[model samples]
Target chain A: MTERKLIVSRRKLLRVGALGAGGLMLSGCDSLNRSEGFRSLLEGAEDLHKGFQRLGGEGALAREFAPSDMSPVFRANGNREIADSAYRQMLAGGFADWALKVDGLVEKPLVLPLAALQSLPQRQQITRHDCVEGWSAIGKWQGPQLSRILDMAGLKPQARYIVFHCADRFGSTPYYESIDLIDAFHPQTILAWRMNDALLPERHGAPIRLRVERQLGYKHAKFVMRIEARDSLAGLHGGKGGYWEDSGDYAWHAGI
Target chain B: MSEAVTSDHFKGGDFVRRHRLSTRIWHWINAVAVLVMLMSGLMIFNAHPRLYWGEYGANSDPAWFEIGSNADGQGLVKIGDATIETTGVLGVWTDSEGVVKKRAFPGWATIPSNYSLADARLWHLAFAWVLGLGVVTYLFWSLLNGHLWRDIRMSRAELHPKHVWHDISEHARLRFPTGAAALKYNILQKLAYSGVLLVLLPVVVVTGLAMSPGMDAWMPWITQVFGGRQSARSVHFLCAFGLVAFFLVHIAMVVLAGPINEVRSMITGNYRLPKDREEG
Candidate 1:
């Protein structure tokens, strides 16, 4: 009788917990439905999206397709040419002097040259790149996993966000993007140096570019020049994390 | 049984419950949600005026449908080899500032009444939460209450060609059922409602999910079932248009059949039965 009572009570508790979780989800949607301000609506909806994805996406890997499924033309989106003289010089010397500086809240600061990056063990993935403008293209990318670099850098306990500084600039604003540690540690996240078995071209961000497979196109930072680990995104450009987020209405987190 | 009231001028007149409370609530909420989603979605579609098939499509790829303006400043919508001019409307229209611009889906119909894809997405995703959740919950509740079988499901008699033909012709003539018959759905009504509920709604949601790269991780079959991302998008695009067409027909039927009674029935759940004609 005692054992039976305990099991019944535990089942009741489980029922209540499920009801509460469902109610909480409803309230999250309710606020988005009721909010009048655009910014509040944006923030609330984004959080809802993040929470929904986090529940089921912890260990899930993005779907990979066969090489035969690759798109014939993977059009490079955003800023076609870099006007900066330093980037041109790096291009001229074939990125011989170019190096990615990884600093900020890290136990060890490391600057890895292009050659050093290529020397690391690489993971090749053929994944589709989805653009916010409603276009998709599949391309194979090979590079060192971002998790490996973070392991080598040894992030300090205070580190919460990893910001990517880039050589490419859109108009006057230098391009940059940031991601939470969860995304930073994803196995598929890589600083790719090669596309389709060839060296990464300038239009696709040479030397190295970040390939976050699960996100929209803009989050894949091209012409990446630096990586900084930080505690908060508060003081970053536009305080929202990415160049597009600052200038346009693009969501900083494009997981959806 | 024809029951005559104290006044025998009208026979078999009575009040009937046409919709449940939950159904009414879902219906009203869906009205707002679908409108918001549709308008914002138009703005998102404006970002890419061209539509294609297969796995990939961009400026370089061959397009099956496109909205563009010609050199003489005339707007046109092109689908395959055929083209139709739509100046001052879809392809080319002046904004609030009165400056003529070449754009798909003019500003008025879009959210914010401006060209902001970011804000448009915010509105789209925001209302999509309501639209998606409402449908799912409503369907669940409907099943538990046997509302699907009791009301939505058609009877064997309903599938008879003669019964369907009668309903279709009556609806075409703008003549609706009266008295006790008005309590249950006619054949045409059941077909339209079932089409919207079981077919169009699910197709739009699935194809929309298939477009999301994140969802690709969760359900690879979502993309696979639709063939590819671009193919899914095209299907999603067509389904949305189908929904809009349904909405137009719904509104028109309501108006022609007597908006006061139809709208009141949906709102308050009490419908006043139309007068029965004798010798019919």
Candidate 2:
């Protein structure tokens, strides 16, 4: 009788113990999941990633591939055609009369014509375009270094975030993006006017587009109309530095 | 533990030290990190909803793997050479908002429990750091503390085909070691643990690093190692799935071997062995 009673009690013990331990295991994870301390820890990880990436600096260069290695067809993402009337008219005229205005917080507020941009020293690179949505394509981009243009414009002392105002609009607001001086001054950052050894197509941001090579594709603003430098992005369209940032909650620093 | 186990001793009323305190701590820590990573990762995968082979993959190109809804609002998963319908579960389901949509993974299984890829990334990245750092630390600690040398590495004799096959058969038969034999890890447990710690985790981390453009700039070969960024992404997904499989098997082993003893050993570092006469 004692042996049978012992077996019965042990069975109960096993059941209770398993249930209790399993419940604790799950609830522990759940509690941590909901905590602010956990969130901060996650943010700390992001900052660490940013800091580690910035360590490479100007010395770092994105991998450039042979022209033959370019994807047979590059995917055009987000706003292939803009609804802006001005963009339509500019597209119709083949961007002949279009001028990329370089103003705002600059010593020399100059307007650069498409022909003038072509005349500048050009850098052609066949590099991979990584989108945040897990797709990638390689295309040869030819454009003058953005640093060269920024140098020509002569950035003011207060200049910090370099904002690219594009002609395309998602809805009521115009498509735009921004980068810090680190990316703006990088050799790979360019206002590309040509792709795959030919003039850039409307589907892939014709006339001119920003190419901050180290970042995800969203930072490569298309249909660039104006370049503005500001101390902070507080007053920008989304106050988060990009259109996707305002609407989609995308990270402004897409170095990852 | 070697596969050439000379005997099977499953008995009760014996207590043995199964897991070291450090192992238990690391195991549970990883449990949280891995679960968070997998859930958030599913959310990240939803952003693309397609997978392809080779260097570049997009909507225009043919995908080897895809998950989406059909015209009739039914979910479907398409793999190379096969297409299977799985609605109310995978591709199409009701989200947290109680509205039915045809997204790749439902909100119930994702971090943030919504359609926010940005927030999902935050969860994934945060846990990634935890899992990565914890793993590195545990590995180094185990090595220095002689845990790896004393326990994990299999003997040359165990690597023999016949010995290994015997262990496989025993596991298949749901036969577990008890009493004195329970003090050590079986061949299968050793192999599974070592594979996860030494092989799978490192592959997952490196492939993830390869997908980062920042890492590519520092060392272009990082992405090139797997052919390209898209390939790296595919490999990352596969590896995460591998880890999930490992988790499922690990849980099943714990339950099958007796959840009471397994859970207690992990929590308290003392395992009370079941009787050898215990049924399979």
Q: Whose lDDT is greatest here? A: 2
Cα lDDT, all candidates: 0.82, 0.83
lDDT of 1 by residue, B159-251 (tens): 999999988898878778876676667778888888888888778877877887777776778888988888898888888899899999998
lDDT for model 1: 0.82
Candidate 2: clashing pairs of residues? B10-B275, B10-B276, B11-B274, B11-B275, B11-B276, B12-B274, B12-B275
Best model number under TM-score: 2
lDDT string for model 2 (A1-256, tens) is 9967965776688788668866654455445556888766665666677787878744699989887777888999987987678778888998988999998889999899999999999999989898898888889999999999999999999999899998877778888999999889999999999999889998889889999898889999998989998889997776988998888767778878
TM-score of 2: 0.90
User: For residues A148-251, could you state the per-residue lDDT of candidate 1 as single tens digits?
Assistant: 99999999999999999998887778899999998899999999999998999988988788998878899999998999999998888788899988888578
The reply for model 2, stretches above 4 Å from the true place, is A1-41, B1-12, B96-98, B278-280
Q: How would you class the docking of model 1?
A: acceptable
Task: Show model 1 residue runs off by greater than 4 Å.
Answer: A1-38, B1-13, B277-280
Docking class of 2: medium
